[model samples]
Target: MTPPPYMGRTFPETTSHYLTTGTDVLDSAGVEAALKAVTSKGYGPVAGAQLVLLCNEREADLISTWRRGLPSREATADEVAADANAVGPTAKYDFVLSASAPAYLTDETIVGRQAPSDFNGLPVFDSYGEAFVIKSELIPAGYVIAAATGGPNSEGNPIAIRQHPNAAYQGFREIPGAEQYPLINSYCQRSFGVGARHRGAAAVLQVTEDATYTAPTFAV
Candidate 1:
């Protein structure tokens, strides 16, 4: 089923920093060091890894909110079988995990810390009879998302990323005439949107014993 419409817009930009240097400085080690720092942090309207992490945080929020609005229950064997058959017997649920979950699963004191064999060398754990993928970088610390997978088509996926058909309006594009010699210029832009595609395809579980759910925080 098509997901209900829940619309919003955001234009989050990264912090901007500038560097001033003479022509001699360009060839110096200080310039190299500065460039390395910028690459690690971010520069000019884009926060590099920070931006990606923020986007992932927002996406997780959307998925959690969307799932919470739907009915909650345990999946029956028949329903699981149907889901498997619906997509050529490859369908299954995925438990996307983040932060403390991974550490907890691997803790020596808690789970015997035997270092469970990796799933085909991937970062996935299948000890719970379902794939628990570690996504600490993308997901918040306390949440685990159980999502249905291997649906009939693109829309079968719980989340969708929509982009304009026109190439000019799709990915990051650099603005012209923003550069001058000796001093460098940097600019990039993109257009895209994300939303839920299938209803009843996912659920969110806050891994907590508290009376109410308290959102976790991460360092950007």
Candidate 2:
């Protein structure tokens, strides 16, 4: 069988907060609980450590300067700021996938929907970008990925960045509910399509940080 289509789009997800808001500091156990709650939501299979590295020890201005010079970090302050500078800008990539297959379907929503499933058949995709995130429900090290759709909402579709048919995807320029639909800007060749019309996968999941890092792609 061609496998019945899946429904809903909330991959299993886990988050951590580097923040502390209590008389007592957040310990390992308490932090773990917060993480579990987010993960349990089926947002994603995001795994990473969240540490309170005590940046309070440093001065405010120096914090930025020092952190900027640090060795290996995911995103730069400028990079994150720039991406959000202009709204409604699309991005480029090697490929994108949606991980919320049979992963997350809350009671009311799942009532008439198909169970979520993954290419691995295990359900849930874990491939998030740790770089672009400035803040997350995940702890300090908490970062993960969930395959998902990207494109105009009206089309009920996602655009694949790189690979096609299965890996690469293109857009039709008209996204239903978008404030403005962009004319077909061929960022790249279409290696993939959706439904019988395009003869491609009905869905394409995107890994926030999987592809080219030059341009950052944020997830839902």
Candidate 3:
């Protein structure tokens, strides 16, 4: 079957950042946890590593806070003083994918209700040009490779199941048990292998409810 409407939109730009606390105010352990998760699988030479961070609202807030608080490594003495009073830290990362994205959904939400009018009040979505962090839980259980072009071999290809063109997928049909409701079934029938040639290219670091960021306590 054809992909859903929400799949049409392009993903946010691929960006990278070296997550650092720079001070003990934020948990260094948590920062390390996030860092290890992203680089755990090592980096990809061709793809340059696309690390997608999946976080909830609270986690996003914490990350954004840490990002804004960290001191800039490249700032000269004069430049640093010019903006010493800035409240929020300068963001050098890609945009965080909010709940409005198409992939952010539970299985129950998709099958039960029709597409909603607004996804978390976001009627439109564009490439997040600031931070690489994405705030959606619907991403697949592994590293998510962002789509890209111009690379040797399959350096930037999408992660998909490859199948024959004609017999790639099955058409939509009705189910026997759910005759009353308007449920269509267009599942995949053709056999295909996982289309990820460069697994290292795509990576994700997911957080659970119990996850914590342990910052160091310093003595005065």
Against the reference, the lDDT scores of all candidates come to 0.35, 0.25, 0.36
Q: Which residue segments of model 3 deviate by more than 4 Å?
A: 1-52, 68-130, 139-155, 165-194, 206-220
Clash count for each candidate, listed in order shown: 0, 44, 9
- lDDT string for model 1 (1-220, tens) is 2223222422224322222222211111222223332333222113211101111243334322222123222333655687853211111222233323344443323232222333223343222112223234566544544444442344455468889988787877876543464234655678889887643344444434343445567686
Error of 3 at 212 (Å): 15
Candidate 2, 65-149: lDDT as tens digits: 2211232223335556887543221211111113352345434322222222333233222211211111223312222222222
lDDT of 2: 0.25
Q: Candidate 3 on 156-211: residue-level lDDT in tens?
A: 53355455566424333333344564345423333556675534333333322223
TM-score of each: 0.37, 0.17, 0.32
Q: What local lDDT score does residue 49 receive in model 3, on the 0 to 100 scale?
A: 40
**Residue 126 accuracy (lDDT) in model 2:** 20
Best by TM-score: 1
Model 3 per-residue lDDT at 70: 53
